[model samples]
Target chain A: MRAKTADKIATSIIIAVAALIVLVLAGLLGYILYRGLGHISFHFLTSAPETIRKGGGIGPQLFNSVFLLVLTMLITVPIGLGAGIYMSEYAPANRITNFIRLIVEVLSSVPSIIVGLFGLLVLVNLFGFGFSLFSGALALTVFNLPLMVRITEQGLKGVPREQKEASLALGLSKWKTITSVMLPISLPVVLTGTILAAGRVFGEAAALLFTAGMSSPRLDFTDWNPFSPFSPLNPFRPAETLAVHIWKINSEGLAPDAAEIAAGASAVLVITVLLFNFGARWLGRYMYRKFTAIK
Target chain B: MNSIIEINDLDLFYGDFHALKHVNMEIPEKAITAFIGPSGCGKSTLLRTFNRMNDMIAGTRIEGSVEIAGTDIYSDEVDVETLRKRVGMVFQQPNPFPKSIYDNIAYGPRLHGITDRKKLDEIVETSLRSAALWNEVKDHLKRSAFSISGGQQQRLCIARALAVEPDILLMDEATSALDPISTLKIEELAQELKDRYTIVMVTHNMHQAARVSQQTVFFLNGEVVEYSETERLFSNPTDQRTEDYISGRFG
Candidate 1:
């Protein structure tokens, strides 16, 4: 009788703990949607409200946010995945790999403000790019690189040793084994890492603040030209992403309609992050099923 | 059978630990040779040494010459890729790649620059036929290699190795992970394959050693205890250690 009573109490405690977790998640999701859903609109998504302008759309901000996310993916994907390959496949479990891993962990733990400060000194003042999309993308690259590298390394390491040996045993070279066998096998996880990094790029505000600057929205196509080298990509120009725009509206207070604008921008940001996280997860699952079915 | 591979005073070490010591052995051409011993007796290490697969391991050192077809394969002049092409390997588990059955077999030929679809198809068919797996997998070559059972996957791996037309095949306990019926099928395939290619296999099963191989090498504590005909080794081994190993005493 005593043992059964104790078992019942234990089961109730476990159930309560699980319910607590559900309640907490519901609370977080509810708060964000409740505060944000009311502000979303077409004008809020598209128009870029210029200095002291009341109820103008955030067109430039939306464009800049998308641009930064894409550029960061370009710069970081290769470097991150390459680093991961080196760490997981080529690297030995010795002092060198351990040291590199420690450094990466430390980098991930560093505050976003510090990453912003580093970008300001090294990228803006020292490098003569005051503030622009390029600088912001580079800063975000540094922030997201560690994340992708770690995740990809873990995924690659998780691959069966037998698969690698099988490839090599069949006279495939080291690079071929990596590209043809290991990389493809672990690609879903690598994509997840990249998507996570993109989410950070979209949501980040502190790091892009000083590096990307707040010089009011501009849609100049002259500097945006990609094929020419005669015109330098002028980083002195200010760029506004959605997250930065929200922060700007809250601080400046010149626009009395800033509250709705902030809520709407937050909604867009949340939706993007949700889509990225779920999209990457879905893609990973699809690839796994599709590939595993044939083998 | 004539000798195709010669190992003279070959020694292997993993850091300070001596793995294979003073291994002098000759593997005959186009014959199935079985290496029988308990685990960690350096059979697999010696096998890996043939193609320098142990080069991937850190602090793994090899001493002495492994001459294949009158060439010291371990020489600095030897390209690892070319050496691996001539000598392919299979593992204990059926590690069919996460690719289609046809693609897995064609990976090696493709690496060597055979890109024509008709030629690739020819190679895949011939390889699968040689492995005795063509009939089973002919209609489903487009299917994933991982979709097959353990036994079938092992056969696919064999076909994959054979696609390159390697002169030698190194199998490290290739049938240990299969069912009894699967093990018999692989044994029969190995015997069939021995007519055209040199086969070096490591096995823990005593009956498998006797049944599949014509030549047998018994190893104990990194040393070649005895080497003789399979019948002689199983029924009339001279060395006490060889007798012990064959009779299920101590390896």
Candidate 2:
């Protein structure tokens, strides 16, 4: 009876902690939505900023953010995935391999600001990309590569040993087995990792400030030519993303309705990140069902 | 009684630990040969060497020759993938790939580059029938392999191993994890399969070896204690260790 009461007490404590966490998260989200949702008009979303006035839209900044995400993912996915596969499947269990794994772990834990500075020095200055979107994409790639590789390796490693052995036993070549059988089974985990990294990339601000630049060059949606300076597709142009825009407006206080713009942008950023997380989970579940045929 | 597999002076080591020492035996073609031994007796290790499945293990080294149809399996000229294709294996657990029933059986055939839809369907039907599971799973070919019961899944695994047209099947305690009825079903299936593919099985159940195997090899301390006809090995007194093992004196 004493033990049972103790168990009940422990269970209650755990439940209380969990409820507290949920409450805190709900409170934060509710407060942000309450403060920022009113400023979100269609015009506020689509129009470019006005220098003299207070309440111009964040159109260019939003476009730049999405464009940067697409560019960064294109560069990061192949390299990160390749490194992960090599480390998990091919690398020998030697001191050198252990050292490499150790380096990856340490790199993943390093501050994003430090990575941003490194990118500013090597990519923005040394490579002479000069505060362009390309430079920013490279910076974000460096910042997120360690996370992607680590996640990918962990996901692959989570696949059951029997699956690999069964594939090989059936005469599938090592590479074929990995690509066809192993990768498919671990697809859910890999997708989750990709999305988690994506969510982080979508909201990242510190790294882009030094590498991607603090202000956009006023994009022209009318001019569809990718090569033009004002076109959204120009990788060489300076791009200010949403998170950075919030930081810039708050710190500079130059725009008349800087406080309102900052609140609205923060709300958008929070909502987008939440969407990314939810979308990732849904996609992961869908892939798992399709691959496993678990109707 | 032509022997299809010949193992000569086989010695296996896992890093510094010696697993099998100076072992040898010939396995007859198209017959069920059973290895009956206690735990850690190197029966499974020897089974793995037949298909070169031990190559995946780190620090696993073998010094000998395992010849199947006059070809040395461990030779540099012999491809491991090719050797494995010819020597299919079913593990202790029923490990069905996370695919539909049809896809699971077609997995091996597709790996070897068979892409025709009609051909894959035929192979899937034939293999499942061979494993004696086609009747149960025929209506739900598109269902996940995991949707079936455990017994059915084991048979699915057997069908999967058979689909690749392998000449030999290595079953490493394939029935141990099953129920009595499932075990009997598999035993009957093995008896039927022995007409085409050479079957080598390792089992802890002495009655299983006596019931199904034409020949039985008893192992103790990484060495073959006796290799003889199943009836004689079970009934007659040749080596005291073999007699004791059969009589349930000590494993």
> What tens-digit string does per-residue lDDT give for candidate 1 at A141-240?
8889899899999888878999988778777888988887888788787887888788889989999998887654455545656533322233345677
Kindly report which residue stretches of model 2 are placed more than 4 angstroms away from their true locations once superposed.
none
Ten-residue region with minimum lDDT total, candidate 2 chain B? B237-246
- lDDT per residue for candidate 1 within B1-251, as digits (tens), equals 79999999998899999999999989999999999999999998899998888998889988999999989999989988888888989889888888889988988899878999999999999999998899998999889887778999999999999998899999989999999999999999999999999999999898998999989999888999999999999999999888877778875
Model 1 quality (TM-score): 0.93
Alpha-carbon TM-score of each model against the true structure: 0.93, 0.97
Give the Å error, residue A50, model 2.
Answer: 2.3
| Deviation from native of the Cα of residue B10 in model 2, angstroms | 0.4
lDDT of 2 by residue, B40-122 (tens): 99999999999898999999998999999999898999999988999999999999999888989999999899999999999
The lDDT of model 2 is 0.90
Which segments of candidate 1 are over 4 A away from where they belong? Answer: A1-18, A50-53, A220-236, A285-295
